[model samples]
Target: MTTKFGFTLMSIQEFETWIDARQLARTVLTIQEHHTYSPAYTQFNGSNHFALQQGMKNYHVNANGWSDIGQHFTTFPDGTIMTGRSLEKSPACVVGQNANAICIENLGNFDSGKDAMTPAHRDTIIRITAKLCKRFRLPVNTNSIVYHHWFDLSTGERNNGTKNNKTCPGTSFFGGNKVADCVANFLPLVTQAGAPAAPVISASAVLKYVSVTASSLNIRTKPNASSPKATDRDAAALGAILRVYKETNGWYKISGSQEHWVLGKYTTDVKRATVKADTLNARSGPGTTFQKLGSYTKGQELFIVKEQNGWCKVNMDDRWVSKDYLVFA
Candidate 1:
């Protein structure tokens, strides 16, 4: 195994072993499959793994204004896997559907008239996905493993290519990028490779929403301070709403399918509310004497973190607004 730009480049076998041994602290409900349409097969020279990875990172950071590469991992035509973003944080892929997702970008255009998929690369994609499903206890299905073509290019809705969408993962990726194509061709291979699917948990029905009150809150693998941190450097950003499935001691399990937990002390049960005032001042403190942070227009929705002295704290930071200007849902 070799490391480049803080990313680990590993063989398929090494990746399988490494992922299997890892104890993921964050919850991952979906695995996204994408194709790098720009950096076609010709860009890879077998030994330029680090260079290519760095180039992509630089583009993502400089052009896209993202902190790092969007995808969690990239698969090469030579059957190599290079890590990208940290698994703890949400990926930048798929816009609004990034939360709780692990994105995999296969290096090379897989369109029918574009780069032809190699046998080694094809086998590696199948097995690596299977290994991830097995290790993460994810079911091999359309909902669990998704294609970029399935979502809307603008709104990020799961339209399944019925409307405006990019032919990502390709027009002929694994036969096709449609949901039916995945069900018929791709999922069967993954199921065969990683047999006996893990049991699915039905915990979504019991989840309750809560808003983070602290500027940044830590997520843990277990509901205790001794447990390892589930997220990367920064905590869950202020105003981030998380769904809680279970509560123990004072910690809440934030993930329905994974053992991700966060402290309840820094969170508050919130209700969605809309701004009633045409232009309301967002303050740094609860009183009118506090500095103004910003302003919200009428009908703008925000989560009410807490209320103090007729002022409602609207975000995880010190941003507050008068409760008189909020219409709770």
Candidate 2:
């Protein structure tokens, strides 16, 4: 039989209710430990303390195998979630640390085999990680989330002093970490209101190109003129795909592509051929200024529907801009 940590789904109201129900006598982890992943019938590696103590590296056992508790949680191949060591209390998943971090043991050995991680596992990690981040007030993306390998990298230590054969989460699941990064990239900005100052992708990752040009560009907030604003943000390159949310005017309103501004002036070129060319230039009035507002290159993409007298109407990347701009590209 499998046990589940009983956590009620939390909303602001639900959180308040939980707070009202408790007098702060227990830790936060104890109050909300719902969600769990059960141990399935699978072969086990002798990576537990018992195996380590016996100088053996692999072993087989009952459904509830390990001699000592391992992992703060388990994510099944089927995507179910399970609890292990207390969330508030640290566990020994990463070596030399059991006081500050939580351990989640995912099944599979990507380091030595060709078996791939199931979609169920990837989805579970994403859901659970987001929940953990929300509960801890941590940023919800790659910048905040890290892999065990990252922990190892930052610590500058090897797992048990051996480097040749210690593959923990497997290579396939390592890719799952990238998936987590992608999720972290979009969630927060999507949940917020108003336009971002520029494309501010909360997380970092690769972006594909959709369009291109070669002139210097500005990122504005609203897609209108008389808004009278030009951001220091640049997006002037060829084939450069900076993570971005939307493009208005000739400028691209990028607030969800990266954590900061890459600007239109600095991009190199557009990479993809399918990307449609649509650049809105910053105009004086509705559409009288033959003068150029800004420019852009390939790999940058934006939508254009609003229009004013030969001028294309679009929003700016900055919040202060109240009007749109126009461009002829």
Steric clash pairs (candidate 1)? none
| lDDT (10s digit) by residue, model 1, range 190-250 | 8888733654555365456686667668878899999998743335654466767899999
Stretches of model 1 off by over 4 angstroms after superposition? 195-262, 267-329
Give all candidates' CA lDDT scores. 0.78, 0.34
Please identify model 2 stretches exceeding 4 Å from their true place: 1-68, 141-143, 151-165, 174-329
**Cα lDDT tens digits for candidate 2, 17-37:** 332332110011111111111
Candidate 2 least-lDDT 10 residues: 24-33
Index of the highest-lDDT prediction? 1
RMSD of 1: 9.3
User: Per the 3 Å backbone cut-off, how many clashing residue pairs does candidate 2 have?
Assistant: 73
